[model samples]
Target: MSQITSPPRKARQAPVPAAGPDDGARARRVSRLKRRLTPYGFLTPTGILLVILMVTPIIMVITYSLLDGVITNKNPAFIGFENYAEVLTDPVFFKAVRNTLVFTLTSVVVHFGIGLGFALMLNSPLLGDRIKGLFRVIYILPWLFTVAIVAVLWRLLLSPNGVINYLLGATGLTEGQTEWLANPSTALAAVTFINIWSGYPFFMISLLAGLQGIPRELYEAARVDGAGAWAQFRHVTLPQLRPIIISMALLDFIWTTQQFALIWMTTGGGPIDATEVLSTFTYKLAFTRYDFSVASASAVLVLLMSMVLAFFYVRHQKSRD
Candidate 1:
């Protein structure tokens, strides 16, 4: 009876609840940790791919640059810096380098200029949204085409009897049918023009995004300060878009320097090497001349220049952050 009474007399107690400030804090800590790790977790696959694909190829190229003979020899000999020295002294390499620099600088200047103008037009509040959308689609259309396709299209147009020359003659812009891509003096310039046309769309898209991202308050503030269109563009727009411009310029320069398909398909580094760039030269060294070692060396040099630009870009991005 006593035992039964004791068991019955045990007081009822409420169940302990789980949700509290400490639980919330622990959950929040877990959330923060997940947030911190999420990006890296996502990036891991890409990082692995880059190392396997991009980094491995680069290392292979560097090793090849230091070695002599890839296909012709059974046991490839190590040439050390001899390839570098020879490549550095080669007049063809110099000419190619000069042409590449010229092409990159000229094309980038025109690209930025035209792209900036187009972006400003697109960003104008005077344009309705439908019109803006239409024009934007049109602007990006050229970029959708493959480089090889554009090269083929432009090759046809730049031929002596092609549509472009016909139009030029029809418009009285030229005296006669001219071999635009055949003439040594004009081949590089002609190719340059084609690239500019094909490339400006990319610049336009980038700058347009930059323009759209700009706070309208800045524009209003500028207006309050009695700033006109040009003034507002110079002080407000340019400053905000400076980083984009610089980054785009660096990327464009690197790309233009290494551009191959369009150039090879169009000019083939011909007209007495008038349109020769580092990339074309490298290809010719490897395939045409069957000199893989020299080609690798040249490729290494190009990679070095790209690395320098990439370094600057990384620094710029970090500083911006």
Candidate 2:
């Protein structure tokens, strides 16, 4: 009876159905294939664009810069650094370098200061929303105008017997109408001012975004700790905003150093080369003097300088991070 009570042992069950070896292997292979393809799929477009737009032109520039005469139907004869040597020794090139540095440094400092001040002011409670928006639009309008239009407008304003002279006369600031652009001493300053006016809005908008990203709680905490406005800004805002400021300054320096249109339109690198920057000098070399090699060499130098600035900017950002 006891033996019978042990019910007949259940028939040996077949192993539960398991994933087939082929199916499991196929799925793993498919996943690995997709993982390998994903990165290439994303990079393909950018890689193609860089080769087409950037690498090709740079190769051409380097090749052309080595030649002696204008690159025409005839194959160019490589002159091995001749163009670079000539440019380096030229007085005009040296002058252009000096002017470029001055313009870049002045613009960077003025633009940063003015833009930061405006951003701070907009962040203040004294300025109502509507008023701040209105001012923002007005300040940004100059940036939207093309360089040619800005140059023409400023030329008219700075012309003899123009509105500036009229206003100055009315204010008893000058004896008579002055030719602002004709005077070499004042021409560079006038052009620099125009550049500052046109460029500062870009920095202002950038800094404003950076300012808005900062948390109000940080400021409140600092206040609770008996921090004054200057102390709070110094300890918190400046540190947080450092990266943005450095990036903007580097960009501004590169752009300002290569400025041509405003200088060309307003002064044509004249009042005796007073406003000649690298870009303008390159243009003059290429077009006016018919020296393509020199122009290319100058452009390459400018590019190298920009790269150096970029290197520093990247290093600074990495350190901060």
Per-model C-alpha lDDT, please? 0.92, 0.88
Q: Estimate candidate 2's alpha-carbon lDDT, on a 0 to 1 scale.
A: 0.88
TM-score for all models, in order of appearance: 0.85, 0.87
lDDT of 2 by residue, 83-131 (tens): 9999899998899899888888999999999999999888788989999
Model 1 per-residue lDDT at 122: 97
Encode model 1's per-residue lDDT on 191-294: one tens digit a residue. Answer: 99989999999899999999999999999999999999999989999999999999998888878878899899999998899999999999999999998888
